[model samples]
Target: MITKSIKGIGKAVGVMLLIIFGVQHVEAQQFFSYSQYMNNLTPLNSAYSLIDKNGTLNALLRKQWTGIEGSPSTFIFNGNLPIESINGAAGLIVMNDQFAVEHLTEINGFFAKGIQLGNNQFLGVSLNAGIRRYVANYSSLDAVDPQFRNDVRENKPNIGFGILYYSDHYYVGVSLPELSIRDLGNASTQRADFFRNHFNFAGAYLFGKEGDDVRAKPAVLATYTKGVPFIADMSTTLYFKSILGIGVNYRTNNEMSGIISISSDIIKLGYSYQFGTSATNLGGRLSNATHEVTLSYRFGQNTMSRSIL
Candidate 1:
């Protein structure tokens, strides 16, 4: 009986150690990315508006590792409008992200223009301007510590650009959605090694005729940031009669996601659930499941298949 009690106590100590180290790693991660990224590409590349020429409004909410205090939570809004005469599109993106003692908000507006390269082929470029505000309530952690006496706060200007080559069936793009000349500030939390620029590259292809009962889309996105390993996401979605979608995604970090959506001509709703596949996974104990929901409205175009996105 004593041996069993000791074993149980040992496990408890191991778990506490895991939580301490794990939470710090979570704080280091940038949680802006989402599981339903394909539903709204504006955050990654505003130029995607070039191919999808519809007046669009989309909102998304995501909660990561449910039940964990200070886990990441995000809210995003984006709207895009098309200008047929200029072969261009304009859009706005706003996001709020909070985790641990840090909170960040960004607002950006962008314009993209596409030039015809050949039959049904086009190349597009985009430019965006924005402000990023970061505030960390370090003082809340320990009011008695001198280092935590002052909270960190900074507002910085940002500019970014994206380029894409697209047609009716497939598209590929690369973008730096947030570029800033000034740093967040001189805090240990703002380690330059981890606070560098982010790069995004993605591509997608659709298969099947417009009238087909079933269609498939395959997509891949790769992201790189300093002091982090390259992360890649690969997904395949199947759409039925352009009304219902079911998909699965795999991330390089051994994370798996399941997605589903229901759509009409004017509105669409989507949800995704994500979890790690590892035995000692964040989804199991360090945190919990990740949940994301997306809602979108589009007008002026239902002529194009949803796969085009």
Candidate 2:
């Protein structure tokens, strides 16, 4: 009887969370995030298609809230390259996110062109076009209410834009990753805001020797969404001999993380561990840390700017 009661309560809670997520997902932010954003650019800013000189490929995987049921997980794969014939840059991004009964998959293409601003400084403008495929399963609910729908799936169009300015020592960018809002269907025939516009501001600077000397980089990323509080992150990283890197980061009112990475001519590997803060402070002490891993490779002979590291 006790076991049955516990199962019943779990299902009830799941149903409630599902309903709440569905409602909030429309008006609120419905995006996946990574703690180590420094290594990634195109995910937030389409203009970053030209951030690096060599053709690049990157993959990132994140697992949030280990040991927790219905936790969130995200996976992303993206690639970018400069097209000398077109005198521009192009990229492709694919991402998958899953939490509880909700799943989101996105496939996007990016195009960017840069304007020289003298002294090796440049400004870039970009456009992104994509599709979002969303899926939800309500069959897990113990009691299927009339308001609940099962196996909901949808495909929606998405568009975004960005601008970036950069030199050897510093870089700044602003982006609207989701400029077009989408309406996900509701059970009652009333359409709700399924996707909202997301604005992102990001900047980074490098200090120390511009050549072979050790360097320190500090970076920040801020995001804003309608009807939701703003979120920001700050981080500092140290690079040794342009091959190894170590860093720490703090997400405002969220969590703290440590990272390590190794880069080579062939590939780069990075790993991060995040400890929860605030309400999850106690839970973090119980080994429920979030984990993330990243892999990136650069090909071709074109050299990337050293100042943007």
Kindly report which residue stretches of model 1 are placed more than 4 angstroms away from their true locations once superposed: 1-31, 187-195, 301-308
Q: Report the lDDT of model 1 for residue 191.
A: 36
Instruction: Give lDDT: candidate 1, residue 3.
Output: 73
lDDT by residue for model 1 over 1-309, one digit each (tens)?
677656645544543454475654453344478877776777888898877677889999998878766667899999989998999999899999876677888899999999999999999999999988778776665545475568877777889899999888889999998886775665335534224577999899989878789989899988888767678889999999878999999887778899999988778999999888775567765655899999998888543545436
Query: What is candidate 2's CA lDDT for residue 93?
Result: 87
Candidate 2 residue lDDT tens string, 1-309: 777657756876864664454333222323667877887778888787676777888899997667756666899998988876655789898999877767778899999888888887989899989998777766554334443435677778889899999876778999997766555564213222336677899999888765565888899988887756677889999998878889999877557899999887668899999876655342344444789999988887765543236
Deviation of model 1 at 289, angstroms: 1.1
Q: How many backbone clashes does every candidate have? A: 0, 2
